[model samples]
Target: MTNFTLSDLESIVATRAAASRDESYTARLKEKGVAHVAKKLGEESVETIIALVSEDEERVISESADMLYHLLVALHLKNIPVASVLTELARRTSMTGLAEKASRTPQASGGRQED
Candidate 1:
């Protein structure tokens, strides 16, 4: 089996984003703006949930790939590197899930949340 990392996928997505929109779906999605990318991500999320609820492992895997791709596209559109997300995940892993959840301070207005 090939070893594929998220960084590898991110690189591919970045390349596609720079490609001609007519030739690249990723480029087209990027041209459509973040709202479009976010809508695709939401659609993929629902499809993935449906696959999981139906107990279809293969479908779940397929839909998950779609979901992750859309998520990566969304991140790209916002100029957010996947490493930042991985760092957050890594940070959360240091604590129990409940503890992590409790640690998050809700956002006030449009400002950043305080821990």
Candidate 2:
């Protein structure tokens, strides 16, 4: 038996994502399907941003944790790994922020304004 590690939260997220519905919140989120998971992520992100704008470090940290947790759940729902996101981030790390912003078109996913 290879006893490596669930040392990383990504591993934890993966396991939780794959487990039976009763076994974990992340798993439950997966069972509920993509739209539900996406809604939860959106809610958490909004909470985190609200905390940030209020300049409350404690709430910011707390909500940010919730945000990341739900994001992992969303990723699991979509079969996308955290590393994929991190890799894209790594690829963009050297690019000028303004240039990156300009490089993105308004029609990209998540860029549409609410009705």
Candidate 3:
């Protein structure tokens, strides 16, 4: 099996995002900006959830790939590196799930939750 990783995907995303929009779907999608990328991400997320609920392993895998690709695109648009996300995940792993959840400060409004 190939030892591909998120880091590898991130590299690919970076490259494709820089290509001419006429030649690359990633560039085309990125040209549409954050709101559109986010919408695509949401759609992929729903599809992934549906695949998971139906218990079709192949569909779940495929949809998950789609979801993650969209997520990377969104992150790229925001100038956030995948390593930052990996670092946050690693930090969360140091604490129990309950502890991590409890440690988060509740937002005052409908603000984004802190990671």
Put down candidate 2 lDDT per residue, 56-111, tens digits, no spaces: 79889899888888877777667788778888887777798666666667785368
The sequence of per-residue lDDT tens digits that candidate 3 reaches over residues 1-115 is 8899999999999999999998899999999999999999999999999999986899999999999999999999999999999999898889998887777666632356545
**Pairs in clash, predicted candidate 2:** none
Tens digits of per-residue lDDT, candidate 1, 9-107, equal: 999999999999999999999999999999999999999999999857899999999999999999999999999999989999999987887777665
Kindly report which residue stretches of model 2 are placed more than 4 angstroms away from their true locations once superposed: 1-7, 105-115
Which runs of model 1 end up more than 4 angstroms from their true locations? 108-115
- How do all models score by TM-score? 0.90, 0.77, 0.91
How well does candidate 3 score on lDDT at residue 51?
Answer: 95
lDDT of each: 0.92, 0.78, 0.92
Q: How close is candidate 3 to the true structure, as a TM-score?
A: 0.91
Q: What's the lDDT for candidate 3?
A: 0.92
